[model samples]
Target: MLYAYLLSVVRTVAPIAAGWLITQALRLGVTIEPGPVESLVTGAFAALYYAAFRFAELKLSPRLGWLLGWARPPEYPRT
Candidate 1:
């Protein structure tokens, strides 16, 4: 549980970094002005993208093994 919780923090921050990257690309390639509204839309879209993938990796496909940021699986003791 703790492993997942820690991994979840990485998952949460990844979207923000991706959002900034996307926003920079748009600013360079497209003529759209960088403002609050543009940032807001990019942030929402990045969040959605992360949510979709996270859901698929964790819920839809469990066998893929840490497609996100998880370095390894958690270890559990057996009796």
Candidate 2:
């Protein structure tokens, strides 16, 4: 149960963490001389971050909510 909860939280926050890291990296000093390489790297990182975030929200949100108490799990249908 504890592991499940922890995973849920991590899943929710992982993308944000990645995005923050990328943003910081970009802001601190992106001395990558203007070129397609810089744009490619930045765009790739942004896309990866967004994709992770989107997948987590779409696939794990309900489980996360239930695990974190933001919402309840649906009751199983009875026979």
Candidate 2 runs further than 4 Å off: 31-79
Best by lDDT: 1
lDDT of 2 by residue, 36-59 (tens): 778878989987876665556568
Query: What's the TM for model 1?
Result: 0.37
Instruction: Report how far residue 79 has shifted in candidate 2, in Å.
Output: 20
Report the C-alpha lDDT of model 1 over 1-79, residue by residue, as the tens digit.
7777787999989979987987898889965566977887988898787667677766667544465556344466643
Candidate number with greatest TM-score: 2
Poorest lDDT segment (10 consecutive residues) of candidate 1: 64-73
Per-prediction TM-score: 0.37, 0.39
